[model samples]
Target: MNAVFPTLVPDHRCGFWTDGADELETALRRRADVLREAAGEGTRLLDLAALPDGDGAFDAVIGDQCLEHAVTPEQRLRGQHLGVLSRIFARAHALTVPGTRMALTTLTAGRLPRSAATNRALVDVVREIPLWRRCLRPEDVAKACGRWWEVREVDTHQHDYARTALAWLGRLRDREAPLRAEFGDQCYAACLRAVQTFAGAIEDNQLSLVRLTLWRTDQ
Candidate 1:
């Protein structure tokens, strides 16, 4: 199954996946190869949103912790640049020859209704008072994806993800010397701090995963 990666970034290496691997071991091997190629610089990852005639022809798509930053939130819920999102979804739909699936991992704030209401309140208050903008909530993501795709699953990566992020932050801190040498001190420090913030937020249940899948029906 071919997949499209919209708004893909160059410097932040995301990782890799393989298609049609029912066996775990086989998929692991294929994933290892993809990782090796990603690390070895054999494949040229291009920006999908920028590709000309970049529609249709894939069976599935996988995105992790992306799309939120792809377009500004103002552009999403406020009915701005929705055409772009629809176009991407159309291509993804065409890729699946009907009854196929698209699995995506996106950043969301979970499905608790009260939490959503509170977050909205926070956003409204911030909008009026002018403080830091809160991150996107799962409801926002659901509304966005529901525009073009039928969602099948929504999972909250609450506490475990926080632990994972903390672990990653710790590892990055440990590799400070090498990271500083490669990326310079300022960038490395900023990234390290960002990692900690993300972990803290996730563990605190302020950030979550809005797991989703979409299947195209013959129309």
Candidate 2:
């Protein structure tokens, strides 16, 4: 798992895998005492960008909403996001043996049931939100996989994403007072706008939540 909090230790004694940025590492260090007590030696938090030398150690790799933020907005705008994704796939391939599987979920730009202009507009709106760096199409993802991976399945969950966004929006509205106080009015307003825009895009079929299942090919 990349950038996900491990809630349960593996019962099979296999190590729990997770990685994140430096800020996340610092935050985790603050809770080191509690985490050390709860996780003991089962958890191994690593650096995603520079994974240590452990060839063919992991059975599977899972990343949820991690790929969307893999690169910066500048990289995406410069048409370097696909190259970065390909490199990431290659690195993952080097760490696993043939037949190893990888599952990733990310926000993708939708191209059906809506006009191209509308879809582009929606993408632009969401791209303006903080931490939302990349929003590639399904075809772009497949292209990035290249020879390192064989794509098994690509599933879209626009409705599910819209529902989740709506629920989040409702919660935000309910706690607007405390949230505004904590994050300030401007930050709170930005979050509310971001969620609303995301929900609208998903509802209009302009944006989708995509899950991809891929297998490492012999390389």
Candidate 3:
């Protein structure tokens, strides 16, 4: 088994290590333990798509809630989301050796039945957010991996996600004044609405968090 070294973590600001990005650095500083652990490990935070290292340099990769933004709105409109996702998988394949394990967590459409209008409304609400791309179905993710990876396990965390969103919503509500002052009333309101929408969607089984564990296939 390959040891986990030089692990690549994409979009680290979402409660992960820093990649020298200002926002990420700030986030890392907030988590002193993670900052210290990363420092001790000598981890290098490199861009997923543009790593300067040679191929097969990493032993593992973790993509936490970042795959949704792999494709642009235009690509999604053109029905190329899967292709874009496949390209990202290919890039990861090139950066890891055979038997490397990758763990990815993403919010995806749920199996629950919802009216077409409701689904359309949800899409409209999130479509304008540059980072909030369309959520993929679980099978779409498997297809995106293609022959590059073997899906080891897939787990759903709908209730957990809903609870977390609710907690965030409560915190935002409690800190309304301070948050609004810092981020502006409009931005704060939008953020609150987005969190509420996600919470409701998760609780209604219209959205779910899927965690996938995959092993890199032999090239």
Candidate 4:
């Protein structure tokens, strides 16, 4: 797991952890993360379709860099995510109320068609991110959630994402020796390459780090 952005807030019980791996529960707990996983449990989002809508259980669900990796590295897994976006949105709708919303941040495609360089960058990213992803445009996501929510705002942080990627790449490279020792050479290389790919994608306008805020509508 890329501990780079683990969504933990110090001196506040504002954030909670929800991951599929039971092994991470202990680690998250140690970091003062309100662990949502028990000793034996599955991911809440995976089987979210089965559970009845909470109808206001959560204040909001933040899909931070989560949607892009919703599809696994294998194409067969894409069906479970891209094709079933409604299920995911349904779960989100069920979790919040009329006024609450889902705030999502992920990689989204721009209006421009992808160039060859951009396509190549994507290949490197897929290899490093280990996900067979479908780039969902911001509008596409809004349409997918149309039944349950409204797109209140869609902000593109293109340059910022590019800069952040470069910064992360630098920080990661600074610790390359230890990272290589811990994660093996291939994994370390992949992580480094992924950051480079993202920087390229953001620079070329092939991708943007988007903050899409969806407001709940009475459905």
Q: What is the C-alpha lDDT of each candidate?
A: 0.47, 0.61, 0.64, 0.55
lDDT of 2 by residue, 1-219 (tens): 111101111110111113432232343343333323322232232223455565645546565556776877788899999998898888877876555666666778664544676556555554545444467778877999999888887767665566556656776788889877876787677667666776777788767877677777895
TM-score, cand. 3 vs. native: 0.70
Residue 54, model 1: lDDT of: 40
Model 3 regions lying over 4 Å from their true place? 1-53, 111-124, 127-130, 181-185
- Strongest candidate by TM-score: 3
Badly placed stretches (over 4 Å) of model 2 are 1-50, 53-56, 111-130
Candidate 3 local Cα displacement, residue 85, angstroms: 1.7
C-alpha RMSD of each candidate structure in angstroms: 10.0, 10.4, 9.6, 9.7
**Model 3 accuracy (lDDT, Cα):** 0.64
* TM-score per candidate: 0.56, 0.68, 0.70, 0.62
Model 1, 46-71: lDDT tens per residue? 22233335444444455544555555
Off by over 4 Å in 4: 1-56, 72-83, 111-118, 180-187
> In angstroms, how far off is 103's CA in candidate 1?
0.5
lDDT (Cα, tens digit) per residue for candidate 4, span 1-92: 24422211111111122343322334324322211221012223322223353354555445655666554435323444445566677677
Give the best candidate by lDDT. 3
Candidate 1 all-Cα RMSD: 10.0
- Candidate 3, residue 133: the lDDT equals 56
Residues 1-219 of candidate 3: C-alpha lDDT, one tens digit per residue: 011101111222223323344344454344434323322232433234344455556766667667776767678778899998888888888887655677677778766546786676566556534444567788988999999988888877675566556656776788889877776777676666666776777788888878777777895
> Which 10 consecutive residues of model 1 have the lowest summed lDDT?
1-10
Q: On lDDT, who's better, 1 or 4?
A: 4
